[model samples]
Target: MSDDGQDLAEAQRAHWQSAYGDHPGMYGRQPSAPAVHAAAVFRAAGVRDVLELGAGHGRDTLYFAREGFTVQATDFSATGLKQLRAGARQQGVAGRVTTVVHDVRAPLPLPDASVDAVFAHMLLCMALSTEEIHAAVGEVRRVLRSGGIFVYTVRHTGDAHYGAGIPHGDDIFEHGGFAVHFFGRAMVDALADGWRLDEVQPFEEGDLPRRLWRVTQTLPRERA
Candidate 1:
């Protein structure tokens, strides 16, 4: 990462921490549309455990737990994870949900092929550079079992916010204190190189109605 990238990362982390601290459940207590879709996908694939990246406040994590899948949720903001834990207890699903303060730039704190499925909603589109995004996806791949499913969503280049902010280069733009790396179709295809690219459905979210793609990909099963 360039010096600018490193500085942006630190600033984003601090911004998230403060945001969660001030707003608590800033995103409200509902699972995202992608999470709802992913839960069905995981269930159909017979997934028993799920690892959720960038699971802010864990609305989706708890939903996965309530749906009977054990969940491990991670986010860079400890404050957000704190809220998630409290919500889990309140929902009486604490036994099935675990929270970790993790940055996607680092390796996942799990053994290889340890998780049945992985879900990351709008995480890949953070302030991450293109290389870092690939690395983060690599970490996701490393943690997933063979034939595991990976469902993630990202704001795309067509989003209204894509080119409307302080340009940090590498498709990253900072707006309203949030830095986003809007993804392009080619980058998405490149990331799915070794995996089976299952589906990429366009969707919209929030009042900004952030334009995104809900991508579903799977690994090949291990040979006998």
Candidate 2:
């Protein structure tokens, strides 16, 4: 990472820590629509375990646990994970959930082919450069079992805020202390290169009505 990138990452981390500290359960308790959709897909595929990146206070993570999939949720903010664990206990699903403080820029802290499914809601668009995004996806691929499902969402170039914020180059922009890297369609396609791309569906969320793409892909089963 360049000095500027490192600086941005540190600043983002501090910002998230402060944000979660000030507003616990900031994203509300309901599972995101993408999470609900991913749950159904995971069920149909017989997934037993899920790894969620950027789980942010565990709204969707708790929902996945209630649906009976054992979940491992990761986020960069320890404060956010604290809230997630508390929610898990309150929901009586503590046994089904685990929390880790993880930054997606690093290799996932798991053995290869360890998880049956992975979900990341709008995590790929967060202040990450295109190379880092690809590396993060590579880590996802390495940790997923063959035929495992990967469901992720990203704010796209079509979003209203795409170019509205202060530009940090490489498509990253900062607004209200939050930095986002709006993705282009070609970048999404490139990231799915070795995976079996299943779907890329458009969706909107939040009051800003953030435009996003929910991408679902699967690893190919190894040949006998």
Candidate 3:
């Protein structure tokens, strides 16, 4: 990792450690709906090896492991990893899951074309800049095997600018003193250059009426 990348990782680790260190159910105990749906898509695509980035608390990691996939999960937070380990033992899938402390701002430790499926939930939005998003997307494309699947979810960029259900301008939104970038269809298409778009849908959270986009893409057999 570069010096800048290392610094960024350390910063991210500190942020998550402070944010979710005390909350056992940080996001939730159960796997996210987007992740569950992505798992089904991977199963349908005949995926066996899975790599998950920003795997907070291992809800999806444990879910995939229990379903008989070799899972490698990475996060920057040691506290989050500890919680994940506990969750893995509780779920009886500790043997199937491997946890690594990693910062996505740096190069991923995995080799090229090493994973059959890659999952990133709320990862891109966590990036504070477009450059970071591009870097994250590049890494996602780099580790996925040809014809592998990439599934992710992000806050609806549109929702933040306009009202929740109304259409508005293209700008970042301020909520709870945090800046979040919602994604648009055009931005999604640009990010998925080498991947075949399988599905893109806007759906609301089960607990809230706010909408977000879920995107699934398959790596191209040949580079575009």
Candidate 4:
């Protein structure tokens, strides 16, 4: 990576570290609405092993573990993962969950065709550049098994804070010490190349009513 790229990566990582350090369980205890909906989708698809990106504080990771799915939960924040691990132990599902500190901007450490499902909540809209997002999606496509599912959520252009703060990139804005790359319908469509897009629906959550797009995609048995 270039110096500029490295600098951006460091800044993003430092921001998350500070954010998680300040509030260990920042997103709260309950799983987000997208996660709740995703659980049912996984159940219907008979998913077994799940790889969750940005498993912040393990709220949703715990839900999947409790549902009898073996999960590999990953996040960049060690402090947040510590809280997640404690929660997993308390839920009596420590054996079913594994935690790893991973930065999504880099290539994922997981193996190809190893997981039946990949779940990411509010991860795609981070400070990643367009190239990085494409790289991350390529990683997801590689790690997914035949017909494996990928589900992710991100803040969309329709959000109240879409352009509320300092402009960073296309739709990216810096607010509250964090840089967020908000998505639009066109951006979502561009990311759906290798996989069969199941859905891309808009929804809102949180006390501030954060606008988001819940995307579901499935890998086909054969690739081109």
What is the C-alpha lDDT profile of model 4 across 139-208, one tens digit per residue? 9999998999999999988888888887866677888877789998888999998779999988888878
For 1-103, candidate 1 gives per-residue lDDT tens digits of: 8898899999999999999999999999888889999999999999999999999988899999999999999999999999999999999999999989999
When sorted by TM-score, best at the front, the candidate numbers are 2, 1, 4, 3
Cα displacement (angstroms), candidate 4, residue 50, comes to 0.6
lDDT of 2 by residue, 50-127 (tens): 999999999999999999999999999999999999999999999999999999999999999999999999999998
In model 2, which range of ten residues has the least summed lDDT? 160-169
Where does model 4 exceed 4 Å of error?
1-5
The list of candidate 3 runs beyond 4 A from truth reads 1-13, 160-174, 177-179, 206-208, 222-224
Tell me how far the alpha carbon of residue 199 in candidate 2 is from the true structure, in angstroms, after superposition: 0.5
| Number of the predicted model whose lDDT against the real structure is largest | 2
- What are the clash counts of all predictions, listed in order? 0, 0, 3, 0
The superposed Cα distance between candidate 2 and the true structure at residue 146, in angstroms, equals 0.7
Residue range with the least summed lDDT across 10 consecutive positions in model 1: 26-35
- The candidate 4 region of ten consecutive residues with least summed lDDT is 1-10
Instruction: Summarize candidate 3's per-residue lDDT along 132-161 as a digit string, tens digits.
Output: 677888988889888999998887755533
Off by over 4 Å in 1: none
